[model samples]
Target: MTPAVPRPASRPRLLVVSPNRSHLALLARRLGAEGYAIVTAADGATALGELRRSPIDLVLAELVMEPMSGPELTRAIREQLAFAEVPVMLIASRAEADPAVRAFEAGAEDVILKPFHFEVLVARIERRRAAAERVASMRADMKAMDARAAMKAIELGELKDRMYQLEAERRRVSA
Candidate 1:
C-alpha cells in the first residue's frame, strides 16, 4: 500500500519590513488586528533572515529605507527560492513615481501609496492575501503534478522490465 502524501504547510504569516520603527510598529498593529500574525524587520538583511526562519505569506515593505530601499529588499527576497513565490506589496510616497515603477519592476505584486487610510490599508491587505492564496494553490498543483509524473516514470520502468522478460521467454521457447 502506498503511504499518503503529507499536506502543505498552514497559512503563511505576514512580514512587515521597514527601517522606520514607528511605521513598522503601526503597520503591524493595524494588520495584526485584522487577524494576521505580523512579524517586523528593520532592514533588508533582517527581513531575509526572518523570512528564512519562518514561513511568510506576504511582505509589505517601504520604498525608502536605510541600507536597502524597498526595491532592494524585494530583490533580496526574490533571490531566495522559498520567497520567490511569495507576494510582495511596496509602500511608497505619493510623490515617487519612479520608485513605484521600479518597485513593480523589482517584483512587487502591488504598490501602495503612503499616507493611506487605515480602512484602505486593510482592504489592500485583504486583496494581497487573496492573491497570495491563489499563488500558493498553483504551487500545490504543480507539486502534485510532479509527484504523479514520478510515479508514472517508475511504472514505465517496471513495464520495460516485464517486456524484456517476456521477450526472453518467447526466444527460448521458439529456439
Candidate 2:
C-alpha cells in the first residue's frame, strides 16, 4: 500500500457563545465549512469552561446573554494568561446605543451588528488570526534574542576570568 499522505495542521479553533440554539448551529455550520474547528457554548460561563478545558484561537460571542454579558466574558478571558492573546468579537442581536464602544472597552477586538454578512464575519476571523500570529511570532523572536544575549553575557564572564588568570601568571613570572 502507498504511504498515506500527512495532513497539514494549524486550523484555527473557534468558540461560538450564544444562547440561541439556531444561531449557534448556523455559525457552527458556516464557520466549520470555512476551515475552523468549531466549539459551541451556551453562555459566557460555558465559554470560559471551554477555554479552561482547551485552548481556543478565537471567540465569537453574543452581546446579550443572560447572567454574563459578552464584555464581561471578554474581561474574564483577558485576565487569564492562556486566553489573553485570543481574539474576541461580539455580535449584537439588537441595535443598542454605543454597544460597540462598550464591547471594545471591555476587551473585544471587534463588534458586529445583527444580520451581519457571512463574508465579513469570515474576513474578520481571518484578520484576527493573522494579527495573533504576528504577535506570537514577535514574542518568539524576543525570546530568542534574549537567549542570545544571555549566552553572550556568559561568554564575556568566561573571558574576564581567563584574563584575570593571565594577569596573575604574568605577575608571578615578574616576581
Model 2: lowest-lDDT 10 consecutive positions: 1-10
lDDT of 1 by residue, 1-175 (tens): 1222232345337899888899889888867656677989998888888898988888888988889988988988888887897888888898886877899889988888877877776677678878778877898999999999999999999999999999999999999
The best candidate by lDDT is: 2
TM-score for candidate 2: 0.92
- What are the TM-scores, per candidate, against the unseen true structure? 0.82, 0.92
Segments in model 1 whose C-alpha atoms lie over 4 Å from true places: 1-12
Candidate 2 deviant stretches above 4 angstroms: 1-8
How do the residues 1-175 of candidate 2 rate in per-residue lDDT, one tens digit apiece?
1222232486779999999999999999988877788999999999999999988989999988889999999999999988899999999855687889889999999998988888888888888888988999999999999999999999999999999999999999999
lDDT of 1 at 115: 79
Model 2 shows how many backbone clashes? 0
- lDDT, candidates in the order shown: 0.83, 0.90
Number of the predicted model whose TM-score against the real structure is largest: 2
